[model samples]
Target: MRRVVQFSTGNVGRHSLAAIIGRPDLELVGVHAASDNKVGRDAAELCGLSEPTGVIATDDIDALIALQPDCVVYTALGETRPMEVIEEMAKLLAAGINVVGTSMVWLVTPRQADDWLRAPLEEACAAGNASLYVNGIDPGYSSDSAVFSALSLVTRARSVTVQEIFDYGNYDDYEYTGTAMGFGNSPDDPLPIAFQLGVITSVFGGLVRNIAAQLDVELDEVRERYEPWYTPERIECKMMTVEPGGLAAVRFAAEGVRSGEPVITVEHVNRLTSAAAPDWQVPPEGQLGVHKVIVEGEPRVEVNTLLSHPVLDVTEAGCLSTAARAVNAIDWVCRAPAGLIAADDIPPTEMIRGLMW
Candidate 1:
């Protein structure tokens, strides 16, 4: 069993902790809590488990490193604090601990990432002879593995696109849905942080670049666009309410252009309610969320993935998928060379070891 540590206990982090504790191949050694209230709490209390695992949560970084875990499942908040997350992962890598995480979307394809984001981690990996792998649902599986696998069935591929269609009504994080996503804000107001200059490109652009690299094509440039929709009437969600004319839905895309044409694209259609954006794309059969990958070629291919949980809604199931991707990568990452490992470096789905049911 590979000794492992789970960092953070938020929505995705909680799932990571639970998975680590439940998986027989991984031994849970420590938990890192981001907030003071979470500190000292049992791993069970934090992850909604019925039993205790004896592991307590801590905010102490050095203590976790001292445990000498083979890898750390990092699911901290990276959207807003990318630099800080990078530094934290560097410290862990430099301490000789491998890391597999859902943080740092750009790191999904580190070779294509800018120097500002990739250099430090490379140096840290060299210093301690460790590795780092990052992934999630959209920027994780849907964009990379699913797309590449689908392309394998095609004769001639012209373009590739990945779309994330989500209804944020069930998402409980108000700060994320309301503020970061601009759900409850006015349509005329400046774009939300998520849509601000270069944000979408920074997050989803890696997906575009990754496709280009796999196809062995050079991108002339990466471009982004954001479109927001307003609610006709007041719409109430679990997190917050959107008044008439408030931002209720958004459609954004980051395109990887080659020779002045977009050959690869990552798009997202996010709405607070089904009725909010009638004109934009919606999940098939009125589902809450679905990830779709389309490859335009002679033998056109399309794959749609819907995640569901026994007790959780589609939004939370999405989080579970994210955690599972990182947790499942623990063993593979531990055996890889010391560097930032991309999804292409890991074995295919069938070869990876874990629960089949």
Candidate 2:
């Protein structure tokens, strides 16, 4: 069994930690939390597990490292000085401990960025002969596996477009409101628009570019558009914004030019409200959401798939499955060729199997 140390106790963090605790191949050696409220709490209880383990959460990184864990699973958010978290991961790697993280934008495509961000981590991992892999459900699976799955049916395709539509009102994270979904704000607010722009351009930019290259399309321009609106009346929800909902709908469309013409269009959207167009049907109950992939070519076809469970509730079985994907990738990530890797480079079937077991 591989000794593992987990950092953070947030939504994703808690789920990942639970997976680590249950996996026979993995032994949960330590748990770390930045928050004092959670410190000294049982790991299993914190994760809502039935049995209580003696392990108490700590904020001391050095103490956790002193346990000499073989790997560290870092799930801290990117907003809280994410670079610093990456730097610490580098330190752990340099100490000969393999690292797996979902903390930053690196999971999408680390190589695409300027070396200033990617180089140091690479150097540290090499020095310690350790490895790092980062991944998550949305950018990790939906954007890659779901898209690739769609591409399998097409014999010839001029372009591929993938779109995910879901209500953000279900998410339990409060930070998601103003920062991610733009709660309690007017449709014209620049903050929401800016947030959407940064997300699409930063996370999915590489996915779009990679798809273009796979299809042999030369990309000229990639753009993101945002549309936000407020409901004239209020809607009440336990986790989301107040009644009179604030909806921030964003469309991230990228145009890939081949032969001086737009050949490929990739787009994704996030809707903050429950209102769908009059012509469109509302999503069924317990439905996290739907994914549509359209191939534009001769006898153009569109395929729609649904995830039985949405990831809004971290404690749900579906959420565990998603989190386990990232967790099971740890060993492969440790053995992966140095540098940034994309999901297309990794096999999802194998990842899913490993996680399910």
Candidate 3:
């Protein structure tokens, strides 16, 4: 079993912890916790496992690196503190620990990442001879790999469009749902999601560039757009509450232009509830969320993935799937050559899914 450690037990990170324990080939060796409440707790206790693994959670970075784990599932938050995450990733990689997680979106395409950050990562990987791969459900298998796989079945590919339609009312975090996404703020409040156009461009831009590389086409520019919806009335869920005339839906889109024509695109239609943006894309019946990929080419092919389980709702299934994407690929990433890797470099899905939960 490959020695593995869970880094930060938050939304998706907690799922990574479960996935690490579920896999027969992976041995849970350590748990990294940032919250004071989580520190000093048993790994199993944090994850609600049947028995303790004799491993305790710690906030000491030195201690984690000293473990010399084969792989670290670094699922700590990076959206608001991206630089810190990147710096920590470099440290882990340089210490010879292969890393995988859903940290930064630019990591989806390492080549086009910011020079200052990407250069350090490259240096660290080269020094320690370790590898890193980062991805999530939407920017990951649900979109990039799925859309690219569809393109293989066609003769001539034209354009690609991937979409995620979700309702965040069931999401656990209120800060993210209310403030970061503008779920409870007034419709007129300036959304942080809208102001980060450059960041969005870099993240989805990588997906577009990867597609262009596969088709041997040059991309001219990448673009991002955001549009939000106003709540028609008061709404409440298990997580947060939205008042009338407050922000309810946020629609964001990114495009890759080639020869003045858009070739690759990713869109997210997020809602607080089904009634929030009825006109916006909604998943099929019985599904909490859906990821749709449409390739407009010869015999346009479209693929729709419904992320919902018998017990778990769409958000839960989606989060688990995202965690599984990186956790399942742990062995593949660890055994691969040292350096930044992408979906194209990964082995087949059947080979990567060594042990399913």
Best by TM-score: 1
Q: On a 0 to 1 TM-score scale, where does candidate 3 land against the true structure?
A: 0.94
Model 2 stretches astray by more than 4 angstroms: 193-199, 243-245, 254-266, 276-286, 298-305, 309-321, 353-357
Highest lDDT scorer: 1
Count of backbone clashes for each model?
A: 0, 5, 0
RMSD versus native structure for model 3 = 1.8
Q: Candidate 3, which ten residues in sequence have the lowest lDDT sum?
A: 348-357
| After superposition, candidate 3 runs with Cα above 4 Å error | 349-353
Q: Give lDDT tens digits, candidate 2, residues 1-357.
A: 778888887777888998888887888989998887998988998888988777889998889989998788887776447578768878888887887766675456555655766788888878888877776665556556666667777777777777665555555665743466566666555665335545656656766676666666667766555445556566555455544545534444555566666555556554445552212333445554555677776547677655544433422443454566568877676667655556666765557544456
Q: Model 1: per-residue lDDT, tens digit, 1-357?
A: 999999998989999898888888889999999898999999999999989889999999999999999999999988778789988999999999999999878888888789988999999999999999998887789988888888998999999989999998889888755688888788568878998999888878877887887898888999999998888899988877888988889899999998888889899999987878978888998589899999999799999999987899999999999998899988888888899988888877622677753
Q: 2 or 3, which is superior by TM-score?
A: 3
Report the error of model 2 at residue 268, Å: 3.3
* lDDT for model 3: 0.82
* Clash pairs, model 3 backbone: none
lDDT of 3 by residue, 263-330 (tens): 88888888877878888788887666788888888888989887767877778888788898788888
